[model samples]
Target chain A: MVNDNILGIIAGILTSLAMLPQLLKVLKEKNVDDLSPLMLITLILGLSLWVWYGVFKRELPIIYSNAFAVLVNLSLLSCYFLYRKSG
Target chain B: MVNDNILGIIAGILTSLAMLPQLLKVLKEKNVDDLSPLMLITLILGLSLWVWYGVFKRELPIIYSNAFAVLVNLSLLSCYFLYRKSG
Candidate 1:
């Protein structure tokens, strides 16, 4: 049987890394028309909560994943505005 | 101090609901030119793992949030293909 935390770690890593492709795309294309600001805002908010929850639960995987997610989402959010303004 | 599970629940709800506007926009606009198929695919995979993690942990909030998220992401994925094909 698979360990649950191991699964969680894998899930967390994938989920966090999932932002890379989109971020890179946006950076390369310099377009944010398809990315919704509201979605980014809500995602950041949700990710913040996840970080806090992980902290409270003493779950390192959860904390690490969400913490990194917050950074990636923040980068995307900033890029959205930056690219939109410049483009 | 705030309850961790409460935070988790709220995070889950927001994260799950975060997909709504994008999905709605895609459905109404019938255009997915900006959406990345690779991102959608990875998101679905990550969400699936999260669902399994929730199940192993027996965390209802995680399960519910991720399960709903899976459906929403799947819808987005299908819409990506459908609209891509149609448009």
Candidate 2:
């Protein structure tokens, strides 16, 4: 059981932080034309739902991981709009 | 409990398929210069771990959702390489 929790936490961390590279790339390049807004919107919604699910299940890992994803995607989405036309 | 499971399933479906729009955009536009291969690679690795975690937990929703994400990301990653130089 302890191993399982550890695995879950690691998986959560990886998935939650997976978008950091993309965010960094966008920040450095300042180009967002190729990215689809729909993707970010959908992902944000999905992540929000995951947070809700976690809350209902009282699962801290799920809640925190998905909440973190939502924040990352939101920032990326903002960058998308900010740089959409410039790119 | 049943409601929680349903919520989880819905969340799984949304998150699992969240990349579809991005994938579709890449296919139609055939431009992937802005897409970070590192992002996809990391996400795929994380999603694979999610699948493993799910299997260990015997959670069907988690297993199938993350499995689907892995496939989608793999396809996206392939496109990233195929179109990297062109764009």
Most DockQ-accurate candidate: 1
> Residue-pair clashes per candidate, as listed?
0, 0
lDDT of 1 by residue, A1-87 (tens): 999889999898777777688788888998887778888899889989988888887878788888898888899889888878653
What candidate 1 gets wrong by more than 4 Å, as runs, is none
Clash-forming residue pairs, model 1: none
lDDT of 1 at B56: 87
Q: What is the TM-score of chain A in candidate 1?
A: 0.87
DockQ of every model listed?
0.72, 0.65
The stretch of ten residues in a row with the least summed lDDT in candidate 2 chain A is A1-10
lDDT of 1: 0.84
lDDT of 2 by residue, A1-87 (tens): 447667778888888777788788888999886577887888899888888977886767778888999999899999998988852
Model 2: docking quality category:
medium
Worst 10 residues of 2 chain B by lDDT: B1-10
Show the lowest summed lDDT stretch of 10 residues, model 1 chain B: B78-87
- List each model's interface RMSD: 1.5, 1.7
